[model samples]
Every structure is written in structure tokens, then in C-alpha cells.
Target: MAYTSLYRRYRPDTFRDVIGQEHIVRTLVNQIKSGNIGHAYLFTGTRGTGKTSVAKIFSRAVNCLHPVDGSPCGKCEVCLELALSGNFDILEIDAASNNSVDQIRELTDKINFPPTIGRYKVYIVDEVHMLSKSAHNALLKTLEEPPEHAIFILATTEVHAIPATILSRCLRFDFRLVPTSAIAARIRFIFDEIGVEYEEQAVNMIAAAGQGSVRDALSIADMCVSFCAGNVTYDGVMEVLGTSDPVKLVGFVGNILSGNVDEALKTVAEMCDSGKSMAILASDVAALLRNAIYVKTCETAAEILSLPEEQCAALRALGEKHSVQKMLSVLKTMTATEGEFRYSTQHRILFESAVISAATEAPAAGTTAKERELEQKIAQLERKVQALAKPGFKSAPAKEDAVQVWARVASELQKKGAAFIALAATEAEVESDGGVFRVKVGSSSCMKILTDKSNRDLLNEAFSSVCGQKLVIEEVKKLDEDKSLPYITSMFGKYLEIK
Candidate 1:
């Protein structure tokens, strides 16, 4: 006989065996005990959350001749009869393949027929949201008012795709994502039953890789079991899931938080060379950073993170050495980069760039003394610039020529916070005639800045202070079409040299 997969081999057979869905289980068990089962029920949630599993269990319990606490005894005549593959009392339908209007009509046509062996004829339609509009309309009336002997259980992962009309007619039960701890416990039980040797951390890793899906988790566990040759280990699990080691990930995050770009990139290069995917690496790093933040801020982080004590200690050490803000910034960068991987082919480059960016933005504690020194020098320069812009600064003598007078005015403007205007005016030509000053600038941007009211007022005040009299300011244009010389030389050719 062929080997059965772990998920199928360990599928929940009864409501009692279902994990991580107590709310729905309690309600269904009560309904089964009270005989108040609804005609139509809708089970919705993410895959592997026990919607279909619960539906099958409930179907069996309802038809069981002897139900113990709302669960099928599995030994009664009705239970035995319904357990057969050929039984007509409980039917499982894959709505994905049989989603046409005719298929739905055929199902509705048989609803009036009473159960052959059980009290209710249960129809379990998995992925019911895939049904066509006409098919949904065809089954609407039958679902809304099925005969007393007929029951409908519609299971779907995407509940929003289900029409509101159909949704309103059915009793809805939402299944949540199974917790990692619950999944880990279940894996441990399954491994014990099968006599599979595994490390505790390895089992937890497998459970987390499942991402709250029992089937997905079990599928990964199956691979791990086979790959490890019956002795599952943490390294084996990491290899199977394509994730990094938690200790290495913690160290990688440490490099980032401490602004060690070289070490961080070296780790990334090593992972890439070993055939690890950049996208998965980014996700792992992000999850580790998030956990570190929880350890830093949350009081009960040990309980919340669900990681092993050793791993938590490492994260706690990392969190204690770094601020929450720096970790959050790195986490944000990594998450944003993960989204971009879908659109680009250069995954390694993008990942490396994000790592370098995060490391570069690390807090002051991460900066080198030389970098801090440079930052201080920059601050000093800014203060000097601000100081030079103060009032009461003297200018050139009043006896200076128009060129010298204009140079003095430009220097004063540079000191008074009009640096751009002062720089642009350096290339312009100035002339003084009858106590009127005319200026000509080549570039339109420079002209606009020079013509501004604030800049114009600065220019006028500088001229008044330098030339000992207020001069009328006028902007002029060049009429001589000489393109050989530069703008400055063309305007100030006789006064200046080409050099």
C-alpha cells in the first residue's frame, strides 16, 4: 500500500480531536445534543483552520445512533453505515469542479429524497464560493428552505466572494488561525504516536512554518520527518523551511542595530551563496526584529513570542542593547523591501541595499567617533554661517568702482542669507549711471531670484550701505548677440579678463 501523508493520516476524525476552534466546536456540539441543527450552515476561514474538518465531524455526530457529548461514538450502526464510502446519507461535494447551474439543479432536485440510513441527508460543499452566479441562484431556494431531512454545509476560505443573499440564509461559523502553541502541541502528540525522534525547538519551528494551518504545518512536518530520516532536528527544519537559524538571525539583526554594515552584508552574501532566497531572509529578519521589539516593550514577551528560552534570551539581550525606535525603523525597512521583491529580479541587490540603509540609520550609539566628529564640524559650520548673517557688518569703501561696489554688495548679500542670489549675482554685470544701478543676469532662475522683493530689498540696502547713497535698482537684458564669450565675460568683458 502507498504511504499516506501526515495531514491525511492525522486528520481530525471527531469534534473532540479538533484543536484551536473551541467556540465553533461548542456551538455545533450543543446544537447536535439539542437536536436544533440548522438546515443550512456556512463555515468560513483561512485554509487548515478546521472548517471542513468540523463539518465532516458534525455530519457524523448528527447521524450517529449514539452520540457521546455531541460527538459520534463511532461504533453505532448509523455511524458504521455512514462511515462507508458508498453511503448516500452524507455527501461531500467539491463546488470548485461542480459549480455549474445544472450541477446545482441536480443537487437541488435530490433534496426532497429522505436519507437512506440517517435522520438527515447532509451535503458538505467545500469551496462553495466558487459556485457560479446562476448556480448560487439555483441552490438559493433549496438552501433557504430545505426539507427537514436535508442539511447543507457550505465551506469557503474566501467568505467575501459569497453573495450576501446566500450568506444571510445560512448559519455562519468563522474558524480562526490555529495558534502556534496549539499546533506545536498537536505536532508533539503526533510525533510521539509515530515514534518520531525530534528536538523540541525543531517541532516549534515546524509549527511556526505552518503559519497557523494544520495541513500546511503537517505537510512541512512530513517533509522534515522524511528529510531527517525519522530524527527531526532544528537545522533540518530550517533547511526544509528555507529559513535562517534564530541565533544567526539574532546576530544579523545585531549587526544592523549596531551599524555594522560590513558584517551584515557578509552574512547576507553567505546566505545568498548557500542558495537561500533573499525574500525569505527578509521575512525572517523582519519577524526576528518584531519579536525583539515585543521583548523590549511587552512585559509578557516570553509568553507572547512562544520562542524557546535560549532564543528569547538572545532577543532580550539584543533589545536591551538597542532602542525600540531603531529596531522599528529596521523592521519597517525590511518589510517595505519584501514587497518590492515581487516586482524586481535583483532580489539580492535590493536586500543588500535595504540592509545597508538600515545599518546606516542606526542610533548615535552605533556611530563611530570619527563620524560624530564630522557631524560636530558640520554643526559648527552652520552656526558660523548664521552668525555671519547678523546686522552691522561693514562693506568696501565708497570710493570703489561699480564692479567693486557690486562685489561688496554681493558679499554682504552672501552674509545676509541670500547665498543663492549672491552666487548668481557674481556672474552678472553692473553699471552705475546718474546714481542709478542696472544689473543684467543671464539665467532666468537667477533673474527671478534677483527680482524678488526680499532679495531686491537686500540688494538695495547693501548698495546704500556700500555706496553711501540709495540707488534705483533696475534689471537689464543683453542686446549684443555675442555667443563666443561666456555670459560673465560678455557682460563684464572690458572690466574683467577671460583667464
Candidate 2:
């Protein structure tokens, strides 16, 4: 027999077989059993969460002669026929390939035909979002009012691209990413059925790598199975997955934490010589820092870390040696430079420089970590100064609604050209720290308009309406070009000249 990939071979054929999606399965099964199934259904979620599989199973259930607990009985004539690829009753369309209006019209032409082998003609359109605008228009009427004998199941990873008209006509089911525990359980089940010897540690590694995709987990597990030669071990899994060795990861983080610049670069060189990817190395360090943060804060560190017992324990031990601020600095660097290292021909220089910069620099007390890091590097190159609070750095505000409030303030600032200033300041470091709106302008001209004493009260009134408080506005100037649009500039110029 030819080898079928693990994900395909162990694909869930029934609701009972689906992992980590109990909520969706229960609702769907209930609907199927109650015979309250709608004519059109929308299944949306991230890839590998079983949207497509559930669509297939649901198609079978609707047409099956005998459904067991809302799932198709594979033995029934209708179910058996639908299981085959050439079944006329069930049509699986890849909307990605056939996304034009003509294709949609052709499929709609078949809508009047009742199932040749079953009571209903089931159309499963995968990646339904790929349908063009005209194709969507063609689908709207049919989807909203398909014949009694026709059932449409549209699946999409991105439901947002789908028009609201189409959304309103169908029953929408959003799928969540399969959790790690569910993935691990499924992997264990697959390995047992295959009679493959595997360690618990090895299984967890694959599950974590899947990052909440059952399909992804199975693919990694399949690779591990072939690589392990019947006996899967933790080291074998890590090697195949390109995850750094636990010991090396610990050493790399430890060197960075201790500010041993020499040792850190040496470790990077060694890893590179060993053929490990720079991107993976950076990612590993970032993940390690994240797990360390969890270890320090969360009471259930082991439950949260997702690493093997030994590695998790090691992180816990190391957590006591680091502060959250220090870890954040390292994390900021690793994450910021991950993309750079991925594309840089001089990966070694970028990796070393980023780490060295992160280690040597101490971010200001209130600056954003990401922004502050860039500023720190620029400061080093040009020897400029980092500015402190201008006598009154406003204290912390209520919380998350600051952006919404600031937007209102900008709207109110329109009369005084503060609106143009606000729009122009978009590219600058405009942020709300505390209840204060810190508006940094790239152009000095924009800065003058925002900071003009006349516009202050207008901004204050806007803040009052949204926040129920008259907040402060802090202005700073930075290097940037003329950001004002030509139309806005003309309008503002005319208004100012009249005033």
C-alpha cells in the first residue's frame, strides 16, 4: 500500500474524532439531530483547525441514510457514495481556482438538481473568500435561496473578505485554534494506532511546534516518526524540528542575561557553524525569554511553559536570576531583529550587533521598549541625547480607551489645523502614556500648529467628551518630511489666511 500522510490517513471522519473543538461539534451535532439545518452554512477559522473536515462530515450527515449521533454511518449507501471522489451528489469546489463569476454561474446551474444518490446536493466551497466580486454577486441569490434539495457549505480561513450580504444569509460557525493538550492527545492516539514507540517528552515537543494546528501537529509528528525509525526520542524530535537544544538555548540566554558579550557572539558563531538557522536561533531565544517571564509570574509555570519537565524546570531555576525588564529588553531585540536576520546576507553581523546593542542599552523609564531600542541605537551612532519628561510628563490615565479618545481630540482639532497636525503626526511617535496624549510631529511646521497656544483648549474639550477628563498634550519634534497632504495643506492655508 502507498503511504498516506499522517494528517490525511487519520483525518477525522466523525464529530467524535475531532479534537479541541467540542463547542463547535456539539452545536453542529445538535443542529443536525434536530433537523433544523439551514440551507447555507459558513465555516471560518485558521488553517488546520478541521473546518474542511467538519464540512465534509456535515455534508455526509445531511445526506446519510443513517446518521449516528449526528455523524454519518460510513456503511450507508449514501455515505459510502459520498466518500468516493466522483460522487455526483457531493461537489467539493476549490473557490481559489474557480473564483470567477462564470464558474459560480456554472455551479449555480447545477443547483436545481436533487442528489442523484441522496436527498440533497451538497456543495462544499473551500476558500470561499477567493471568489471575485461578481462571483459573490452570482452566489448571493443562490446561497440565500438554494432549492430544497441543495445545501451549500462555504469554508474560509478569512471570513472578513466575504461580503456582509453573504454573511447575513448563512449560519456562521467560527473555529478556534486547537489547543496544545488536544493536539498532544491526538498525536498520542495516532502513534499508538501505528504501534510506534514514542516518549511523552517527544510528543509534547511536536504538539508545541504545531502551535495549535492539529494538521500542523500531525505533519511534524509524521516527520518525527520517519526520522526516529520506530523509536521517537526527545532529541530526535528537536533535531528534526530545528528547535534548539535545551542546553544550548539555556546557555545562549544565560550569556546574554549575564552581559557576557564575548561569550554570546561565540555561541552564535558556533551555532551558525553547526548549520542552525539564524532565524530559528533568534526565535528560540525569544521563546525562551517568554517562557522565563511566565515562570516568574504565573503560579502554574509548568502548565504554561509547554516544554518538557527538565527544560521547564531549568527555566524556573533560571527565572529567579533575571528581572522582567531585562528579559523584555532581550526579547525586544530578538523579535525586532528576527526578520532582519532572516533576510540579511550578513546574518552574523546583524545578530551580533542587535544582541550587543540590546545588552548594553538601558531604555528610559517611560519610553516604549521597541521605540526606545531604536532611539538608543541611533543615539549611539550620532551621540544625541535622550529627552526626559518636559517638566510634566502626565501620570497614567484610566487605560485602553486612550486611542479612541485621542482620535476624537484630533477630530475636534480640525478648526485650528490641529487635525492636519494630528494626521501628519501619524508616522511620528504619537502615543498615550498615562492619560497624556504625547503627539510627536515629524515636521517643525506641524509641530508649531499642534503646540500653538490657541489649539490647546480645542484639544482639551475633545478629550473631555471622550474621557470625562481634561487631559494633557505633550509635543515633541523629530526628523520627518512634509506629511501634510496637498489638499489638507491647501485647505489649511486658505483657512489660516482668512483668520
Candidate 3:
């Protein structure tokens, strides 16, 4: 016999054999047993969730000559023929390929004839929503009232794409995505049956990576088995998935929470060099941050995370080191950067920038270790500056001939149309510390003129020449409430000028 894939080889033979979707399987089995089967059945769900598989089993049960309770007796001639030779009455059509009106019309005409061997003529149309509008309309009347010997089973991943008229006549059954635990159990059973040795963490990783799809889980497991060559390990799965190592990712998080920017950036660059896709890396970073946030708020460990025990223990330690607010902020940055990466030409640049930017964002509202370090540094710097000053030199340093200096600087600045002077003082106070000068602009209109970089540079150079010190000039933002009346008076003054 030819080799068959694991999913097909282990396909559910009966309702009892089905994993997950117990409610749906039970309802279907009971309907078949009670002879309450509908003319048209619509099965909808995500891909690889067993919609079509259940449809096939239901069709066989309904047509089996020697049925066993609610299931088909696989030994029966009708069931065996249908399963092996593909019975004429039990027709399976791919609506995606034969979606034209002509094909549907031919199918509708064929439905008028009775079953050749089975009790009912069953038409299983997979991906039924792919049918064109005309094709759907052509089948609508037939679907609403088909022959007594005919049954239509429509299966689709997208139910909304099918018209309401076509959907109204059918009994809809929604198949859910198999849960992680259920999928993992099935995989574990299969691995054991195949005599494959695998790590528990590897199975759990594959299950979670599947995202609630049994087929996806199986596909990933298959890849792991082949790559490991008998021993399915978590490291093998990670290598195949090209995902950042959980250990390295946790270490990266620790470095970040400890405010080790250099180490964090280095790790990020290393990940990029390892050919890890930025999008996947960002997703992993976001997941790690989310777990940290959960741990910080919930104060629960091991029991909360569904991963292997060792991984959960490491995440719990990280949760203690980082605040919930900080983790949430990091998650937001990663998520936002993931969106930008869609059209980004320089994803590495974008990812690096996002990481650096996240490092500078505010932490939780409480005091943190990073804040304590900054405060300590600021205090030390303040003491150093205090020590540098002469003892008891508290009085304001001698006001240099600032009045004379400003007059000269003011003349130089005036040449550049900055006709302004300090408002607080006639001259500036200068010493080894720095220069402090106040400008008096009799008219607020000249604020922009004095603030211009060119004029500011001229004044600074003129002052430095006279006072022998380098200085920085800062412009104060005048309060709106303090200047609102002046603007009102200016408007009236403009009116006077016009008059």
C-alpha cells in the first residue's frame, strides 16, 4: 500500500473517533440515528477543523445499509463502496473550481434523478461560498426544495460570503477551532502510536504554535519529527519555526528591565543577524511582555502560563523584575512597530529605533530601580559642582560692565534688525559659572527678532568677548493670561494706525 499522511491515515472513522467538537458530533450522530436528517446541511469553520471530514462521515451513515446505532457499519457493502470507489450518489465537488452557473445548472439537473445505489443522492460542495452570484441563484430554488432522495451538504471557511437565500434553507453547524489542550493530546497520542520519542516541551510548543488548528499543529509536528530524525525536541521546533529562542528572549527582557540598553540593542542586532524575521521577533517580544504583565498583575506562576514548567518559571522571575506599566508600554511599541513593518523598507532600522524609544518611555507611576540610579547621579553631580566653588562665595558675582557690553552687543544685533535690549537688567552678571543676561524688548513685537538664531549668536559672541565666558541664552514663554490684554490693545492700536 502507498504511504498515507498521518492526518489522512488517522482520519476519524466515526463520531466516537472524532477529537474535540463533541457537541457537534453528538448532535449530528443523534440526528442520523433518529432519522431527523435535514435536506441541506451547512458546515462552517476555520480550515482543517474537520468540517468536510464530518460531512463525509454523516453522508456515509445516512446511506449505510447496516448502520451501527448512529454511525455507519464500515463492513457494509454501501459504506465500503462509498469509502473506497467514491460512490456516484455521494458526489464531492470543489465549488472553488466549478463555480460557474453552467456547472451548477448541470448539477441541479442531475439532482432530479434518484440515487443509483445509495438511499439518497448526497452532494458535498466544499468551499461553497466561492460560487458566483448566478451560480448561487441557480441553486437557490433547488436547495430550498430538493428531491426527496437528494441531500446537499455545503461546507465553507467563510459563511458570510454565501448568500442569505442559500443559507436560509440549510441547517447550519459551526465547527470550532480545536483547543490547545485537545490538539496537544491528539499529537501526543499520535507520536506515541508512531513510536516516536519526543520531549513534553516540544509537544506543548507545537500545540501553542498551531493557534488552535489541528492540521496546523500536525504539520508543525511533522516538520519537527523529520528535522529531529526520531527525537522531537523543543530546540528543533524552534529552529524550524525560525523563532527567537525562549531563553534568549527572556534574557533580553531581563537586560531591558535592568536598563541595560547596550545589551538589549546588542541582542536585537544579534537576532537580526540570525535571519529572524523582524515581524516574528516583534511578535515574540510582545508575547514575552504580555506574559510579564500578566505575572506582575496576577502574582500567579506556573499555573497561569500553559508552556513547559521551566519556561513558566523563568517568565515568573521576569515578572518580578519588571512593572506592569513598563511591560505594557513595551508591548505597545512592539505592536505598533509590527504594523509599520508591513510597508517598511528598512525594517532593521525601524525595529532598532522602536527598541531604543521604548527604553526612554516613562515607567510605572511608582519609584523604580532606574529612577533611584538617576536621582543618585544627579545628587552626585550637584555635590561636585558645589565643591568646585570658592567657600562662602554666595554674593552675586560683580556685575561686569554688562551695561556697556549690552550696548555694544545691542548695536551689533541691531545691524541684523534685532533692535532689542534686556528687560530685567541694563547689564548682565558674568563669572566662571556662566553668563546671565536679560533682554528688555519695549515692544513684544520684537520678541521674534531677538530670539532669532543669528541675532542670538551675535549677542552671545559680543558678550563672550566682553565677559570672557561662554553662555547659553534661553527665551521664556510669556503666559497667555499676562499678554492677552496687550494683544487686545495692539488690535486697537492697529485700528488707530489705519485711521
**What C-alpha RMSD separates each model from the true structure?**
26.3, 14.8, 25.7
| Model 3 C-alpha lDDT per residue in residues 1-499, reported as the tens digit of each score | 8766778767887877777788888888888878888899999887778888888889899998877868888988888788765456787776655324333434444556678777988888888765555456555656756779878899987675677888889999988767667778889999999999998878988876675567777888888888999999988989877777888999987776666789999998898887887777777887677566544444332333335556677887886666655776787788678657766889889988888888767666565788556545543433333333222122221222233344445444444454443321122222332234544332232445445677556667655664544554433332233232332222112211110
Alpha carbon RMSD to native, model 1: 26.3
**Judged by lDDT relative to the true structure, which candidate is superior, 1 or 2?**
1
Instruction: List ranges where model 3 is wrong by over 4 Å.
Output: 1-3, 99-109, 262-266, 269-279, 290-323, 336-353, 367-499
Candidate 1 Cα outliers beyond 4 Å, as residue runs: 99-108, 261-266, 277-279, 294-317, 332-357, 362-499
Q: Let me know the TM-score candidate 1 reaches against the reference structure.
A: 0.66
Which consecutive 10 residues in model 1 have the weakest lDDT in total? 391-400
TM-score on alpha carbons, each prediction: 0.66, 0.66, 0.64
Candidate 1: tens digits of C-alpha lDDT, residues 328-423 = 789879877866787799999999999999999938555467744754554343333323322111111111135545666776787787877777
Quality of model 3 by C-alpha lDDT: 0.66
| Residue 490's lDDT in candidate 1 | 23
What does the lDDT come to for candidate 2? 0.68
List runs of model 2 lying over 4 Å from the truth. 99-108, 259-273, 294-320, 335-499
- The CA lDDT of each predicted structure is 0.75, 0.68, 0.66
